[model samples]
Target: MTQWLVLAAAIAVEVFATLGLRASEGFRKKAWIAPVVLGYLASFYGLWLTLRLGMPVGIAYGVWTACGVALVAVIARYVFRDPLTWKMIIGIGLIVAGVLTIELAGVVH
Candidate 1:
């Protein structure tokens, strides 16, 4: 339970860090640098903690990346107006579905 919570937090942090990356404007904007770097560091640390708590690496990474990608796409559509076409949405859905399939099937131990 706690491990799952840690994984969830890690995913959210990673998504935030990714958003910071976009806001950084290819690292041209200095204001966003500290936050983006810190956010990534914190997120990776969270992942480590989750793994230490017994969650398998494959499952943890899959969930972390899946949620991060989905959330970033949807949020970027609103925040950055970064073109959220139906095709992209479908692709995101497929990515998430694939990850979930792996998770539910216990494909990685």
Candidate 2:
């Protein structure tokens, strides 16, 4: 339970960092740099905690990346006016499915 919460935090921070990256605009915006860097660092620390708490690396990484990617894409669509076309939506769906498969596979082992 604690591990899952840690993983969730990890994913949230990663999404925050990614959105920060967009805000940074290739680092042209100096103000966004600090938040982006800190968010990424905190995200990595959360991931470490989840692993140390006995979450399998495969599952941890899968869920972290999948959720991060999905959240970032959806949020960016609104916040950054990024495109969220059907093709991209399908790709995101496949990514989610793949992560679920990897997690279930790890559990069976």
Question: Model 2, residue 29: displacement in angstroms?
Answer: 1.1
So what's the TM-score on candidate 2?
A: 0.97
Across 24-85, the per-residue lDDT of candidate 2 in tens digits comes to 99999999999999999999999999999999998999899889989999999999999999
Per-prediction TM-score:
0.94, 0.97
Q: Rate the local accuracy (lDDT) of all candidates.
A: 0.92, 0.95
lDDT of 1 by residue, 52-82 (tens): 9998887899889888889999999999999
Question: Candidate 2 has which clashing residue pairs, if any?
Answer: none
The residue-level lDDT of candidate 1 at 81 comes to 95
Best by lDDT: 2
Q: Which stretches of candidate 2 lie over 4 Å from their true place?
A: none
Q: Model 1 segments beyond 4 Å from truth?
A: 107-109
For every candidate in turn, the CA RMSD to the true structure comes to 1.6, 0.7
